[model samples]
Structures are given as structure tokens and as C-alpha cells.
Target: MITNLERFKREMEPARQLYTREIQDFSKKYDALGEMSMEEFPDIDTQDYIFSFEKVNGASEEELDEIYIEISNHMEEFSRTHGIEKFCQNARIWL
Candidate 1:
């Protein structure tokens, strides 16, 4: 029989791994965007953008814009205070 602590650890391990992976992926994307390399940026795959928007089907454009603005403001604050590295590090906490 698995001990309670062992069971809990096993359950939490996957969540932690997933969170770390997401954090790393977001950091990479953020860095890629910050480079402002036109060749690389706006580089988010169109299909991914489409899919993301589709996931939020029915969201008004204004509502989406507001959300984007809010996120941008938060990112700006993080960038100013902690820089990208720490901002991305803290993103996991929010995620």
C-alpha cells in the first residue's frame, strides 16, 4: 500500500512538472517577442492564435481588447520591477 505522503507526492509531481513546462514555454515565447525581430515575431503561429480565440468564442472584441490591455499592463509592471527572467519566474505563481 502506498503511504499517504507518497501518494500525495506522486499526484503533485505531474502538476509541478506541467507548471514548470508552461512557465518555460511562456518565457521562451516572451523572449522571442521581446527581441522584436519581425522575422521571428508576430511569429505566433496563426493557427494557435485562431485556436486560442476560438476557445474564447463569443467574447466581444472590446472585451478581448480589455483583457489584452490588462495583461499588457501587468507584464509592463513585472518587466519594470523584476525584468523578464523574474517576471516569467513569477508567472508560474499566477498560472
Candidate 2:
């Protein structure tokens, strides 16, 4: 039987592919985002989470902007298809 984690992994492939190379490399470093789960994300809107993600920290602001746009759209779709709680619990935005 496919576990939820496996299913989530499979489901995320296309969204992952849509990510910019910068984001793809970032996500890959997180082990397919196994570490992205939020214990208690305080934001009611995902936009807040996206906007506040990773400091510029010498990274390109242009790159971070692109990452935010991609994540905002993709994450909303994922949450709609899945459930709010499930989706939120599974991923976080950080770099």
C-alpha cells in the first residue's frame, strides 16, 4: 500500500517540476521536503508564510520573488485538492 508520504511525494512531482531551478535545488536539499512540516504555523493565510520565508541572506531577491509566486499558486491548489490541515501540515516555505 502506498503510504501518505509516498502519495504526497508522487503528487508533488509536477508542482516540483514547475519550480525554478533555484527552488528545485533548495527543495532537494530538504530531502524531498520531509522536513517542511510545520508544527504550528501561526498564519491563517499561506501568503504570510510565503512572504516571510527565508531571508535574502545574499541570495537573489529576484529568485526569492519567483519562488514566492510559484509556491503561492501551487500551495493553494494543493490545499484545495487535499485539505487545508493536511496540506499545511505537510509543507513549509523556507530556504
Candidate 3:
């Protein structure tokens, strides 16, 4: 039987694709900045960039909250490790 988790995965596919494309585009633009080379940037693993929705549709609301909290934590860690402030500061005018 098709499960809710499976359904959620299917429903979220398009959004995932859009996010991937947008992130890649943003990364390219960020790389274009002459201040830092790609080597200087954090080596972001493909898995780290992916949002894990495993069993999410079947998860309880509390579990879902935990999942989002974990995601936010990871994002904050990535931002800190990769000097996101510098990027945001420089990109602020364009934004």
C-alpha cells in the first residue's frame, strides 16, 4: 500500500527540485565573487544539502518539530562553518 510517507515524498518532489536548482544557482553566483575561491569555501556534501523527509508524513507533530529543529541546527552550523555572514553582507545590496 502506498503510505503517507511515500505520498509526502511524491508531493514534495517538485519543491525539492526547485530548491536544488535555486541553491545551485546561488552557489554559482557566490563562487563568482572574487574575494574567495571555491577551495576556500566549505566542502558541502551532497547529502548534507538534501532535506531528509524519511517517514515525515507518518511522523507525529512533535517528531516533525524535532526534524525541523535538526534541519535548522544543521543550516546554522553550515552557515557558521562557511562564513555565511560575509556572503550575506556582500550580497545584501543585491538582495
- Whole-model lDDT per candidate: 0.36, 0.45, 0.37
Model 3: weakest 10-residue lDDT segment is 39-48
Write candidate 3's Cα lDDT for 10-63 as tens digits. 554454454434333433332222221111121221111232232322546665
| Tens-place lDDT digits, model 1, residues 1-95 | 76654554454444434444443344343311221111101222211001011212355666656644654455445445543432233232211
Ordered by TM-score, highest first, the candidates read 2, 3, 1
- Report model 3's TM-score to 2 decimal places: 0.34
- Cα displacement (angstroms), candidate 1, residue 84, comes to 3.0
Record all residue pairs in model 3 with backbone atoms less than 3 Å apart, i.e. clashing.
Answer: none
Candidate 3 ranges with C-alpha deviation above 4 Å: 32-95
User: Per-residue CA lDDT of candidate 2, range 1-95, in tens?
Assistant: 76665666556545444432333444443222332322323332322123134343355666656656676566556556644534444455664
- Candidate 1 residue spans exceeding 4 A from truth: 1-55, 85-95
Highest lDDT scorer: 2
Question: Which of 1 and 2 is the better model by lDDT?
Answer: 2
